[model samples]
Target: MYRVWNFVTNYSLLLICGALIALVWANIDAHSYHQVVEYPLAFNNWVGVDAGYWLKKYGADYGVTEVSTLKVLSFHYLVNDVLMAFFFAIAAKEVWEAVVLRDGALRGRKAATPLFATVGGMVGPISVYLGLAYFLGSETYDAVVRGWAIPTATDIAFSYLVGRLVFGAGHPAVRFLLLLAIADDAAGLIILAIFYPSGELAPEWLLLSVGAAVAIYVLFNRLPQRLDRGKQDRPNSTWVRKKLSFWPYLIAGALSWYGFQESGIHPALGLLPIVLTIPHADRSFGIFAEAEQHLTDLLNHIEHILKHPVEIVLFFFGLLNAGVEFSSIGSPTWLVLAGLLIGKPFGVLLFGWFAAHPMRLGLPQDMRTVDLFVVGCVSAIGFTVSLFIASVAFDSSTMLGDIPVQDAAKMGALFSFAAAILSVIAGKVTRVQKQNG
Candidate 1:
């Protein structure tokens, strides 16, 4: 019973269940689903005006007047923009730890192999998407070109889950996939920040965001030292110090999020900059290395506290965004499917082979080319981040005629389940071949 409970509550299982429930609920009664998602959670109308007046005053400045109003917060906004900020923060921390920490995938000269594989993973999908778009002629090309990054994402939970099922626990291939996914996530964040802006650039807000991130870094590093210097012997001193240490980062993250939003960039991108600013522990200690004198590393602390919350956030994120009408599938659907299913594996294999040979990077000793190929297939499952990009790439208000395109993209994201099945089959085949040999 305990094992069953553990399995059910596991992060990947929870995400899958959430996505499944959303699909069933949406299909059973899409009207209610839409109504619930679109329902407004109104804030105080302090100025005592309708939504339109606020839109007219501040909306044009941001170029989102047609899409949003300040009068209320919809459930979609709550999940995607606000709640998902923490999700992105977690992702940012993982990326930072991997690249900057001593025990990370990029820590040593040979350890950097996965980084190159990540580049191939991203490049393969994007190149395939663009090539397909070009061959499909001008109209199809224009419609699908904006979503070139959609197939490049690897849903960490889903891909890891499938990889584990195929390769078993503690396999080197699984570790490779995890590192590749982390790199893919970093790339996805960069694409989101560069390609998806809400409106006209607000340079002033961008500057403020950068300044806020810098200040948070200074405070995160210095706060514990200042506290320890004064009161080491006090009762509950450790607890008090821990509690106080967290607030500056919390406040700073919120400030930076707002600044990014005001800057016309997606606020989730704000977490990336803030994450980079956090002090990393020495590489000698390990990935979750503690700070000197028992001071908590801010990045590790944030990840620990927010781990469960981020899982919950992912559930709500899937529930709010994963609902898709199957009947609405079209070109965008096929394009995304082709890019992820075909492009992802090809890129990973081609680039991975090159990196191992010409680049003189090392692959895990036990991992065969077949194992790498299976991992490549597993990496094709692009769900969460892909859906987020689809939402951003095809706005209904801006492209009323292209509403179907957005829905098709959603359908493609849902098709990642097929990729998971393929990975399992590939894994079984490899296992059989090994046994026969």
Candidate 2:
């Protein structure tokens, strides 16, 4: 049991394995698999009836009924945005938790400059959008700009896996990887909350949600210090202590789900709220006080339950949202995919490299700063988050050739994902960083 936990903690490959399995499942079954991840309304408010009426009107001349159109669009949005929130939260929680635990390793280092990498990450994707937007007319650009923040964000698992393969453990790249990734994520989330909220805002409801989060934070703050002492004081029964302590973070996460959904930001931001609820593992106990030991044990237990599902759900949701007619990849897709794959690294490397040098924020002694750009390139793997942005950015009513904005989103995500994978693998195979070094 300890060995299993140790492996999952050291690397999240197991989580990725689960994600691949789920993606395959979603593709095989399609519609039914899509439903389990579905969350149509923020407050469980209904949209199907009115949405059907409008979608039907839009597709009527083309013989596509509004009902079918609305069904597809709504399902796509819910799966990508609503479901992917949990994925983001779980990824965010793991990376953030690791950074918090690794003691002073990055407190003063230039490699610790997550903010600089974050800036480059943000600039890279939006730069892609701005460049693409030039080809688009004005009205189209405004809607898409909301989603510009999407392409910049990176999943911790994806970024870290690449880092491990590229940097090798002898390098201090691990610390830099955690800082920059978390900072980049935090920057993206902040932008999303501000720019990408639901067009419809219920201020009173959002306020209530904020109140709920503050209250949760306060309540947990009041929890017993060194939970081990509390455990030793009572509960002679280990089973009782084990069961209750194990799920604090998961329960906290679900509550955060409800809160963020109500709070106007996408509900996926709920992951951070849940992360806040997870107390730092009380590692101070060399004594291994049963209570602190249990808390440590509890994290080991809860991490699997909460974390594995995130990858599985996101990967499958991505496949559902991303599977485009490969037949369409010829002109537009190849161009778009090329930009994300090629252009992103160019911008990120150029920008991150320049930024690191002026500030003397050198790369890990073992890592060439050029590798930072590689991380940035991988960060461009924006499938889950980017698709969510597309849902909010494009209109189902808006036209793009034979497809709607939602369809364009699906295409873009698949292209970006494919590009990210190929480029990163290519970076590895060619020793791009090594050549640069």
lDDT of 2 at 201: 51
Give the Cα error of residue 100 in candidate 1, in Å.
1.5
Tens-place lDDT per residue, model 1, 306-379, is 76887888788788877877766777788898889888888888888888878778688677766767877899
Candidate 2 regions exceeding 4 Å error are 1-83, 98-107, 135-143, 166-178, 226-243, 246-255, 282-300, 327-339, 417-437
lDDT value for candidate 1?
0.73
The TM-score measured for candidate 1 stands at 0.83
Q: Write the per-residue lDDT of candidate 2 for residues 1-437, one digit (tens) a residue.
A: 24323433433444344345545665576445544434233222332213554344434433444242323334545555456766666555544544554432223465335556666666666677667765666655654444455466555545554555555433455446656666766666676777776535554555544554566555543334334355665433244336556444456556666556555666657566556545555332211123323544444355556555665565456445554333333333333444456556666676667666886666656566666656666665655455556556555456545545455554665556564466557567647533211
TM-score per model over all chains: 0.83, 0.70
The residue ranges of model 1 lying beyond 4 angstroms of the native Cα positions read: 1-10, 43-71, 223-240, 278-296, 397-403, 429-437
Candidate 2 achieves a global lDDT of 0.53
Worst 10 residues of 2 by lDDT: 284-293
